[model samples]
Target: MDHDIDVFAKNYIYQKSILLTKTAQRADWDREDVVSELTLHLLRRRDQFNPGRGSWTTFVKAVVNNRTTDLHHQLSRQRATLSLSDPRVSRVAERLEDIERLRHHGVSIDPESDQCDRTIDLNNVLSQIPQRDRRLCDQLSRFRTADAAKHLNQCRSNIYRRIVSLRKEFSSAGLTDYWK
Candidate 1:
């Protein structure tokens, strides 16, 4: 039997070994060292790898999961050194308290409000355009810019220009004048 492995096998083994090692060592140890060791181990056992047994992907996934579990247990033992008195935890709590206080003061923060207003303004502005421009704008807004360009068969720059034009129209129509 020829001892030389195919390029696909070599690449598959190398990538899987690295992922396995990283998943294993990320919790407590340096991921690089683990990857190096795993690389060497895979290279050494390359001859033993059989295509009939299972896929290289499955084998690598299993190895990664096993290594990750081992590292988790190892790190869990070491984590006892850390105490709850860490200042970062207190800072996070303080920030949460501030948010709660704002809520209590009848001041609500809605993250989607800006997006909703933009969407409403865009719809209103689109209605004023001819049917073709209105349809194009609606399609463009469905995707931000890049996605809209691809979907609408327009260049990214063209999509941006259209959006700008729509915005100007909305402004002129007093749709956003209420914000002033």
Candidate 2:
């Protein structure tokens, strides 16, 4: 009887994951990842499923709904954090560089203007560094050094080197104290 219940539970978990994935049908949510998360969740909570309180299918459905909601929330939070690395920043930065080039060719820009002034401080500082270094700096600011290293697929020492390089660039641009 126990073996039968175990097989039934596993089958239900897989079926629920397939239903959720089909409803989503987006590339962001891998079917396997969702299935594995649901599987782990059920395994951990197996003792909580009581046949006396509810039908087995009802209990399984509740677990499926809860796990799917959690997965959606986790993906949403990840997207929110990743929005900082959007391409819009690079596009705006490129336009700012064009304005700087015009200034270099003797076209005087009004430094007091809001548009130009917005690019004068930290944006300018970040624009001066290589793209990889800029991303490294951003990651380091948001996460611990070890975490940043793991995210970038680099060693801790490499992360530290990039941090030193970023600090030097910021110091040269008079934005050293801004980050703290």
Candidate 3:
């Protein structure tokens, strides 16, 4: 409650909240909830307001419009899980029944072959690195550059040169994207 919201700001929030709920059409999103969220956002950002830059009403309208649209877009990207009928259920059942009749067996799918291969390749590459340089690699994986240097009792510039060396080794091993 940095300052009281003027009548104009209250009106803007009310109007925008209705529009937001109608546009989202989400059962979870009531008009009052949207209004509260918008009001809270305006209040939280009040410290950013500069009176010399603009009018109060203009600031209210701008903040309401931007925040309302932001909430709407966020709500749009989220959806309930597929708890209802699934189109592939019948097809999968039929395939399973055929397999059971023919050989009394079920199916197993491994969708992680590529991931497994990459992990194994990375480990192989890491094993070939010497112990001294390997500590930097291990530390860098757990922390940012500065923190990694601190953990290894080295300076930032030393950490940078070690990083360049590691990157070069990784590049030659054909796992260049792994560092990033």
Candidate 4:
């Protein structure tokens, strides 16, 4: 029993060492460090392995993927921190603010709209409404009264009534002139 356990441990380590090396290569990591860390983690979890349920390689792969993901996140945070204090970054930020101020004054240097592309044509006008009324506007915009009455078995009068209410809300919010 002792010899069998020893062989199993050795085989598990040997197979997973190769696998960790490959994973580290794909992630552009130092293979030696990744393999060393994976070996330590496997040793820590040795008692948890159940050969009947799954292969040792599967467990080691999961650990490697998780560790590499964590490392990537740590490196990303470090890069972000470094960039924040960089003088060039501050200069770029100041330039962006200048461009934004010019754009807001309607200088029209750039053709693209500053707002994100709208899904519905009525979004600009409907956005001024309270959240509860926004859903009604979305439904009205999505389904024409005639189509909704035919497919959804809804009444055209209900759709028209909602549209009239939304138009009143729009006019009260001074959004009607925004479209003009």
Per lDDT, the best of the predicted structures is 3
- Expressed as tens digits, the lDDT of each residue in 125-155 for candidate 2 is 7777789988887897789889989999999
lDDT of 4 by residue, 1-180 (tens): 011224555455556556655543333344566556656665666677677777765665565456656654554455333246567788767656655655677644442443222212234455556774566555545765587555545577875676678777666655554323
Higher TM-score: candidate 2 or 3?
A: 3
Per-model TM values vs. the true structure: 0.28, 0.39, 0.44, 0.28
**Which 10 residues in a row give candidate 2 its minimum summed lDDT?**
76-85
Q: Superposing all C-alpha atoms, what RMSD in Å does each candidate have to the true structure?
A: 16.6, 18.3, 19.2, 14.6
Q: Candidate 3: where are CA atoms >4 Å away?
A: 81-180
How many residue pairs clash in each candidate at the backbone level? 0, 0, 0, 0
Best by TM-score: 3
**How well does candidate 4 score on lDDT at residue 82?**
29
Candidate 2 accuracy as lDDT: 0.72
The local distance difference test score of each candidate is 0.57, 0.72, 0.78, 0.54
How does residue 79 of candidate 1 score in lDDT?
48
Q: Which ten residues in a row have the lowest lDDT in candidate 4?
A: 114-123
CA shift of 58, model 1, Å: 99
Error of 4 at 139 (Å): 74
